[model samples]
Target: MDKSVELLKLGSKIRELRMAKGLSQAKLGAIVFKDQQSIHKVETGEFNPTYIYLLEICEGLDITISELLDFKK
Candidate 1:
């Protein structure tokens, strides 16, 4: 797969996992030290999240980096 497409898939997976954990974008943003718009951009694959940001989010969500990156299509 192309790199962009992979990143988008990973983003989608993160969104799904966050929703499953009952978190809104704003709520997740609070844990990640970002704003709602930033979270929204991540969920929508409109922005490529930074490594540190992704790590912060994963830690806050109690999930591993591998789990966040695993997407099935």
Candidate 2:
């Protein structure tokens, strides 16, 4: 797969996990030290999250980074 597609997959996985946890983008952003707009950009695949940001989001979601990448729907 292409890198951009991988980013989109990652973003979709993150959005799924966040919604499953009943979190708003703003709330998830607080955990990742970002703003809701940033989170929205990520979910829409408009931005690629930094490694640190991805780590923080996984931690905040109480999921492992590998789990976040496991886009099994």
Candidate 3:
């Protein structure tokens, strides 16, 4: 699959998990020390984040990196 497509899928998974956890973008962003707009860009797959950012996102979501990348649904 294309990288952009992969990013979008990952973003969708992140959004799903975030919603399931009852978290708003601002809340998640706060946990990760990012702005809400940054979270929005990430969830929309409009920004490619660094590995550290991904780790921070996982931490914010209270999920493992494997869980974050497990787009199996």
Candidate 4:
């Protein structure tokens, strides 16, 4: 897979999880100590989040890294 495609898929997956939990970007950002714009960037694949950042996102979403990265579903 292309790197851009992978990033897009990761972004989409995060968006899906956020929506499933009924959390807005602003709200989730608050939980993760990020701004809404930052969350938007992540969800749009405009940002390449670091491992620690991903951990924070997963924590905010109440999920494990395994769950977050398990795109096989």
Give the top-scoring candidate (lDDT): 4
**Model 4 score (lDDT):** 0.95
Tens-place lDDT digits, model 4, residues 1-73: 6878888989999999999999999999999999999999988999999999999999999999999999987
**Arrange candidates by lDDT, highest first: which order?**
4, 3, 2, 1
Cand. 2 TM to true fold: 0.88
The collision pairs in model 2 are none
Output the lDDT of residue 17, model 2.
93
The C-alpha stretches of model 4 lying farther than 4 A from their native spots are: none
Worst 10 residues of 2 by lDDT: 1-10
What's the TM-score of each model vs. the native?
0.87, 0.88, 0.94, 0.96
Cα deviation of 4, candidate 1, in Å = 3.3
Off by over 4 Å in 2: none
Which runs of model 1 end up more than 4 angstroms from their true locations?
none
Ranking by TM-score: 4, 3, 2, 1
Clash numbers, per candidate: 0, 0, 0, 0
RMSD of each: 1.7, 1.3, 0.9, 0.7
Report the lDDT tens digits of candidate 1 across residue range 6-55.
76787788888889999998999998788999988887778888889899
